[model samples]
Target: MAERASDVVPSSAATSHSDRGRMNIGQVLDVLRPDFGGITIPKIRFLEDKGLIKPERTPAGYRKFSVADVERLRYILRMQRDHYLPLKVIGEHLEAIDRGLEPPPIEAVVPTVPTVALNSDGLPSAESFARRSDVRLSRRELIKIAEISEELLAQLEQFGLISPRPGTGHYDTDALVIAQTARELADFGFEPRHLRAFKTAADREVGLVEQVVAPLKRGRDSAAQGRVADAVSEIAALSVRLHATLVKNGLHGA
Candidate 1:
């Protein structure tokens, strides 16, 4: 895939403005290195892709950062590290700052996203499991808690990996799980572009599940939907185990 324009940042300009000191991407990283260890060009670009900072462009199309820009980056990194706030919340804070208002405190109103739990018999219960599995997170909360870049989140959504509920604009626990998994993969240098295959495979798997369960769901009886739920849960668990086994075998073969 072609790299996005946001990823190919421009080189810094030679001259600085009289009012504010200007630095290129490298210089900006130097200033932030002490505070944000292991910071990289990609991460900075990711921030820019998320609209966290708006650096000026020189005539050569290089990115030029002012002192304020560096401080803004610091504030965003600090909020994420210190308060576990999501990027959406940080963006709001930045917006408030732009409006000349004090940003709200970092106390998160939404708790961290929850994990799914299986029942005693090693099977997902019809009622309790479905109830517990239903996790609704606002778009901002999903991005913040998942610690994923909005760009990556958008890609995931585009590929149907992390889908928000229809009409509600809120994501469920499955989306959270997918986002969390994607974030972990990103730490190992796997960008969203590389993860499209996983999404495609999952869609295929879901299609297979739907083939079997669609009939059960079509029934008007309440028990029919319950049966469909149970079927999906079983297939979900089996699919996870199968995927893990296949990956393990592939790695060993490699």
Candidate 2:
């Protein structure tokens, strides 16, 4: 379900700065940070590290927050509060919005995959058929897609299945793909203990498949999406028919 915009838009503690030049950055952060769990100066640096906030540097290279920066901070807060999103997801969400695209639904965009049980002819079960054919994920995103408990992620990492990179809890896209693969392997009697290359292979594989989904990931309005989906469906159907002819006949042979 889509959250109401108000539920996700950060509220301003801004005193309506008519003079954007003089707002003390720390004062603004303090007023806004408390709502986000007593956030401190370190949190600001962390958010900066995550690239969610970009403050101006003074002549001496000190950070300075303008009105715009404050709003961006508020946006960061809203993402964490309303979406329970990791920094990477939230950062990209804000970036797309700033670039004039609709933010992709956080839950709808999990990074995965494996072959489910094969049916008679070396194909996945009907319930797990093609999976849009190119679902990709990392170890971290696999957990997110599965909606598994965080404790499970921690356990996987404790076994070195994946690492929470640096200071951010956000998993790399590679982690998501690997995790999904690991889950599938686990079903076939492989465990995190068995796959040394799961993590690295996932990172590499996800990039290869992600190129296909990149176009779909571009955000759009409903009407625009409907048009694109219709076109894609039509093209896909035509391609399938074209495949039948090529497979069975001598039209335009190679």
Candidate 3:
């Protein structure tokens, strides 16, 4: 008996969809790395650690990604680049979408242009407040926060990895956070250079927080500003507490 041609070869539409429907790990990285300015291996692993992208495993335990994964990654990268967001916030935004919840209002993309050298004054032209004086350094003098040098910090700043104040020659508290994050990364042989995708993530997170704060920003009254500040504080505290509780439950519960 002769074999049927349809059984032997897939239709063009079928082949097209096969290309679109799913991808393997390498393929996903190939598609996404360019979007991330060629992210490093450790950075991809970091995303995995944060539960941002989960790939299925084959019988041989190879990871496999789908086209939908690519879309999600695109959105994730978009949020990071345009919004000045952190990964946790980006993950939360994505989580709400995955749960069939409406995405919060779409926001305009902001810039990641590096800040200029901060003068002694430490205030941005737009912001009237002083550089946050509340930053508590553990030491009185320059400390070994990391092996990060002034030049490396400059590069990070140039990529907007760490934002700065206008007047303070030194970086703001967030720079310290990045330095600490860099320290952890160095243990894995990842450098300040390797993880700049975090700047993209940070840009995305800022938008999320801005959207959350937008309604509160509508009025100019002192009362309104206080309410906004208090609300932000409460939300931040609750977010941390909730994460801790959920992890504790996961560890202790059946």
Every candidate's lDDT: 0.71, 0.58, 0.55
Segments in model 3 whose C-alpha atoms lie over 4 Å from true places: 1-147, 237-254
Task: Give all TM-scores, in the order shown.
Answer: 0.48, 0.38, 0.37
Query: Once superposed on the true structure, which residue ranges of model 1 sit more than 4 Å away at CA?
Result: 1-110, 118-134, 214-222
Q: For residues 32-108, could you state the per-residue lDDT of candidate 1 as single tens digits?
A: 78768978889889999999999999999999887677777877877787677789988876764553334544554
Measured with C-alpha atoms, the lDDT of residue 183 in candidate 1 is: 91
Ten consecutive residues with minimal summed lDDT in candidate 2? Answer: 126-135
lDDT of 2 by residue, 1-254 (tens): 43322334323556454254635657776657667666678877888887887887889978877766776777776777777778888776666455333456666663223334444653233333223432333344457675555665666777777775566554544455456666677678875666755456545544554454457657676576655455444444444455456656875574
Candidate 3 or 2, higher TM-score? 2
Best by lDDT: 1
Model 2 scores what on Cα lDDT?
A: 0.58
Which pairs of residues collide in candidate 1? 86-144
TM match of model 2 to true structure: 0.38
Give me the displacement of residue 168 in model 1, in angstroms: 2.1
Among the numbered candidates, top TM-score falls to 1
Question: Distance from true position, residue 77, model 2, in Å?
Answer: 2.0
